[model samples]
Target chain A: MAEYAAQGKLPEVLFFVGCAGSFDDRAKKITKAFVKLLNKANIDFAVLGTEESCNGDPAKRAGNEFLFQMQAMTNIEVLNGYGIKKIVTTCPHCFNTIGNEYPELGGKYEVMHHTQFLKSLLKEGRLKVEGGKFKGKKITFHDPCYLGRANGEYEAPRNLLEKLEVELVEMKRNKSNGMCCGAGGAQMFKDAEPGDKEINVARTEQAQETSAEIIATGCPFCMVMMTDGVKAKNAEENLQVMDIAEMIASADDL
Target chain B: MQYIPNILFIIALAAGIGYFTFNIRKIIRNIKLGQKVDASDHKSQRWSNVFRIALGQSKMVVRPIPGLLHIFVYVGFVIINIEVLEIIIDGIFGTHRVLSTVLPTGLYNFLIASFEILAFLVLVGVILFWTRRNIQKLKRFWAREMKGWPKNDGNIILYFEMVLMILFLTMNAADQSLQSLGVAHYVEAGSFPISQFIVPFFDGLSEGTLMVIERSAWWLHILGILAFLNYLYFSKHLHILLAFPNVYFGRVVPQGKFKNLASVTAEVKMMMDPDADPFAAPDEDATEAPAKFGASDVMDLSTTQLLGAYTCTECGRCTSVCPANMTGKLLSPRKIMMDTRDRLEEVGRNIDKNGEFKPDDKQLLNDYILPEELWACTTCNACVEACPVSIEPMSIIMDMRQYLVMEQSAAPQELNTAMTNIENNGAPWPYNQQDRLNWMDEN
Candidate 1:
């Protein structure tokens, strides 16, 4: 994100991340890296503290329309008043809501899920990655529904994975056929519906079958679900779920 | 009570049969003019849906008041057919033994008594149906949603139904009178309380008068059935004929996926380079014209979709499950199908009668369905999943979105920004392409 700012290719904007932005120790490290990037480039930004609202993704899904509209409008007013024309969110739910769904209430702005924005910066010479220091890392990409089907942007994160010297093992049902992370439709906040297994747990099993070292995805919601899935299947030691952003931040700097 | 009434029933029966036959033929021709329904790969005879929907009367069972009433009326029709045959045979041949041989004397008399009782129940049911439709004015009725030729059709059906009910009752009254007068004999007459009550009126009637009344009653009842059948085609009650075939041909699979796009010839030819492997490069883009990816108008729909619109029983089951509708969003899957049917009928009427179809003349997009309604859909399969008939509303919504975005460039404003980001940077963010791997460099 800083590299793009350094090159004057990306806009300078305030960033508002959701609670899952700082999930665990590993996520904290990646968030620091992002902050470090911002500091190095001297880019202007602010993180929304606990005051950041839920965005009502859960309420909207559960048919609680009253709460969704109120929460949406509140966020809209706050963001619009702040003159935050562009919002970069680590959470796909936040990105999809602010970018896609909020427009119905007359709140419109430029929004990007972080991987898409980061992938773009990598494609341009504005950001350079030192590569090939560690080779033969077998990796499989998980397509988050919001990033792929709902939004129709699928290829950039895959290309970024390839550029990171990661072996890109394609899933059989990649792209539009990608399975949900069991977090969509606000399933993340509430207990899952009655079923023999969680969808994410099933998806993680699909990933583990690939024998990849790392399970990489774009959305924070997917990150949380996939991680829980890995734990549930008792494959936490054998398998791992990491956001593509965190993996990219791990690359050996030139 | 008199021979004149029986004579009137006979004349009415003859006229009703002829009237119904002609109308049914006309409706058949009109429906046949539409596109042929594509054969479904998943289709098989569903005896259960037929049993539940037809004999069990489950669709009507949704509204308890009407459903219960209609059940009695429907069962009445089914049971009375035997009585109808009996009456016809008795009036023509002066013998009742033709149908009575199928069962024992006691059972036959029981069925006859049951039919007479059921006929009275049906008469009361039809009167209530008419009264409810005209007086109560239930807006949820399928007839209320209809436009064009069917605007006043609910009343017409009501009138027809009421007349048939009257004929049924009067015919039963004449039959009871004759049976009581000993003109028509049963080996074991069962308890027909209403028939027994009306029987005393014809005690002293002349033999000629009793015979004439019986014959006329039989004729009137038969003619009423014939007229009712003819009227079924024109009324919104056409669903009676269309629903069976409609349900039979309903998409067997869940309605979510779009029709497989035809191959493009240009892409096929382009792939024929020396580097091409036939197995790897299956001919996908062989489309010659800009294929209608989604429906832009009524005729833009595939024949299966057209059948879906007509097949909808207006059950509102789709609406009940639709997330958009649940969220107070403008998109109601049921309403979409209903509107599509209305638009199709309107367009067909204009084209066939006026010899012109100009979509511009009608604000079809805004008036029929707004852009907001189309966009509100999350493309969830909930509506399709819930629908018993498997009508795919999502495909229709997506197709229109495609046309709006790809052809007209009339998508929401955020799409413009997203597309720009994609076009210029190959991602949906205004960031340098080089920074795409920034996160990889840090760890």
Candidate 2:
């Protein structure tokens, strides 16, 4: 972004790598895969690169208004300073916050989840998705709460998956009625209260009911939770949880 | 002497309607006790919701069996009430079969037959509903929050409908019998498609006896309806009246967007603005009342939220779909809404007793909805989506959590730590902000 500013050349999009995308070891792969797809498509995108900060989703969702505002204001100032116009990210939390909540605080941008952005690119013929080795594989897509129910974008990820020519099965609870992955509302940071069973386990069992070899999801939070769920059931040997970007980037792999 | 029944019907009618109006006003007053919010925007969208969700019952049909049965009861409830107008007119004017004289006999018969069929369907619907609650004993109906009054309230409302339908049919049967008897006041009014089955039950009764059965059933049926109207104030059956308006004012924005606290935003801006002087004195006349961060009691919640509480049918659709509740967590979104309503009513009573809210030590937070229950929410929006009436339990949970974090400084320890980390490191985790770009360096 700094180099682009020096050249006075605006990138087509800003890849807003969120906290999990930047720091979490597993989520970093999703960020990398998304970046590779961008490069492969030859899209001019820039990262804020040490200038970006937290988007205040966790704090806001957790009820710390003071802390949330402080974080939001800081990020808004940075995004506004660059006159950022468009954003794409792998994290639904960031995608949701920056897209829906930031306009009130003076940071306005055309924000899209990676899946939506990728879908638009495919529509524009900039990206061509091939079935390749992933053809005919049984896969189920988990709808992230923020992207699906919160923002009503259930089709973008599923639409992209349809290009894989895979046998796309659905859990009984899908679309608007989809179950939660249990890591939302800052639950990823805190221990869950006592319960008979974990939410992720329940949702994962639903996915397994379809006998899908892979549980494909778009959000980093769902990735972590669903992975843990597969492990909980000792089904790791048979089941795999991969992000949408990870699946697309590794379409040739089994 | 014939006017005595007319006089008694008028008195009962006035008392029933008069008390219902009084109670409705009290409810309006109680709802206004909450913080005011502008629901005046989004007229078209809100109207669309009123039609699609409230009028059409689109969301109700998600669980097809109960949904369809509910439509039977709901549509039947609305359409069958048209007969109440005729009953009122007849009761007031001492006119028998007045509608039969006004409309074409065919049209009147059609309407009457339609009402009778609807009445029968409503009876069947309520019976099935009772079975689902008592016989089938669905898990949602038997949830922890549904043990006592809620349980009986469910049964009582069903019984109210069942009895009303039976009375309607019986009244029709007796009236049709007198029409056959060539009685003077009978006037040959309605087509008795459903009540014809019950007509033979009065096989040998004379004119006086038949009139007695007819008048008694007429009085009980109308009186029962009036009583049911008043009973709505106390029962979850309030949904019958309030669902329309509650859904009209439901959350219109995206589910993920939590409204920022403007008061907190003002302070945050001052802190962020480098040009502002640190030593500047605060404005004296800005306001004297301390800024409350989020909802601690019913008074702090928005009127829409309070309206939502009263609108909840206790259908448990929200609770059944809730991730936290399904996982056996202490949280039940239905319980949150119900608890808010209970606290709000309590506040209403306090205000009524003392002419103003004299702070009861009990509040919605700890007194009704436990912190544990609030914390269990994953904020997944399942409950919000599952609501047939557009009631938002998640927003209430978020607002109470805001009160917990901002007003009381009492969020769970890990959450506080996450907030602190975001403050220091610009991330919820304890990672350096410089490392935000470190992943880009990886070969």
Candidate 3:
């Protein structure tokens, strides 16, 4: 972004690699895979680097409105400073916050989840994807709450997956009825409250019911939780958890 | 002596309606105890929701079986209630079949015939509903929050519908018999497609006995409806009256958008301004009293939420779909709404007894809804979406969470750490902001 500013040129999009995409070892792979696709598409994009901040989803959900507003205001200033008009994120948390919750605080931008962005890129003939290793492999897509029920974008990720020609087996719970991976509402930051079963474990058993080879997800949070779920069930030997971006990148050999 | 029954009928009608009006006022006052919110936006969309979700029962039909049955009872019951107007006028003026005298026989007979058909359909719907609740024992009805009065209240409502429909049919059967007997007041008015089958039950009866049966059925049917109307305040059946308004005020924006607090936004703006004085005295007139951040009690919640609580049919659709409850967590969205309305009613009684609310060492938070239930929610909006009437149980859960975190400063230790991480590292985890671009490296 700084280099682009120096050149007095605007990038086509600003990639918001949220916290998990930046720090979590597993989610970083999704970030890298998406970036590879962005490069392949030949679209100029910039990252805010250190200037980016949390969009306050976790704090607001956890009920710390004060901290959430501080973070929201500071980030709004940075976003408005760069005059960022468009954003793409690998995390539904950031995608939802920036698009739905930021306008009242003056941080308004056109935001898209990476799956939606990738689908659009494919639509415009900017990106090409073909099933290489993933052809005819059984898979199930988990709906992220923020992306699916919350924002009513249940089909974008599935639209991207359809391009791979994978045999998509749906869990009993999918779409608006899709069960949460249990890491939302800042649950990712906290231990599970006392319960008969961990939410991820329950959600994982539903995925296992379909006997799909891969459990595909779009959000970074769902990625972490579902990966942990697959491990918990000792199905890592049979089942794989992959993000839609990672699946696309590997399929196209990007 | 001839005018005595008319006088008694008038007295019963006035008493029934008057008491219902009194209770309705109390319910409105209790709901008004909650805090106010702006439900004035998206006028067209709100009305559209009223049509789609409430009037149309669009969300209900997602399950198909119960949804369709409910629509049967809903449409049948409402359309059938048109006959109640005739009953009311007849009871008052001491006239029999007044509407039949006014309208062309074809339209009048059509209306009566349709009402008879609806009455029979409502009977079938009620019987199936009762079986589903009592015999099949749906898991939602047997949930922990539904054990006591709620369970009985549900069955009682079914019984009420069953009895009313029977009385309606019986009344028609007696009227049909009198018409066959060439009785003058009964007059060949209205069709009896359903009740015609019941006329045989009066085979052994004489003129006096048939008249007695007809008069009793007429009186009991109207009075039974009045009893059901009053019973609504104490039953989950209040949705019959309140679902319309509740759906209209439902969240119009995308469900993911939690509200931004204007009060907090203003303070943050002041803090971020570089030219602001740190030592300056606050403007007394400009600044209002510091408001409590979140809800620990029913009064702190929005009136729309309170209205939602009253509007809850306790169908338990929200709880059944809730991931937290499905996994055996303590949380139940149905319980959340029930507790809110219960606590609000308690507060209303307190005000009624002694001028205003006197704190009773208990509140909606710890007393009615436990923090464990509040913490169990993942805020997935499943309950909100599953609700047939657009009741937002998640909003109430989040508000209680806000109360715990902001006012009580009693957030879970792990959550506190997450908030701190956001404070220091601009993320929920302990990642260095400088490393945010580390993923960009080819390695």
Q: Which stretches of candidate 1 lie over 4 Å from their true place?
A: A1-254, B1-37, B45-70, B82-104, B117-152, B155-159, B184-220, B255-258, B263-290, B312-335, B346-373, B376-407, B414-443
Per-residue accuracy of model 2 over B24-43 as CA lDDT, tens digit each: 99999999988899888899
- Predicted complex 2: CAPRI docking category: high
Instruction: Looking at model 3, give its docking quality level.
Output: high
Weakest 10 consecutive residues of candidate 1 chain B by summed lDDT: B254-263
lDDT of 3 by residue, B299-322 (tens): 999999999999998999999988
Please give the DockQ score of every candidate, comma-separated. 0.03, 0.88, 0.87
Task: Give residue B12's error in model 3 in angstroms.
Answer: 1.7
lDDT of 2 at B429: 95
Q: Positional deviation of B353 in candidate 2, in angstroms?
A: 1.2
Please provide, for model 3 over A115-199, each residue's C-alpha lDDT reduced to its tens digit, 9 standing for 90 to 100.
9999999999999988788889999999999999999998888888889989999999899989999999999988888878989
Off by over 4 Å in 2: A252-254
Candidate 1: deviation at residue B388, Å? 6.0
Candidate 3 vs. true structure, TM-score: 0.98
Quality of candidate 3 docking, DockQ: 0.87
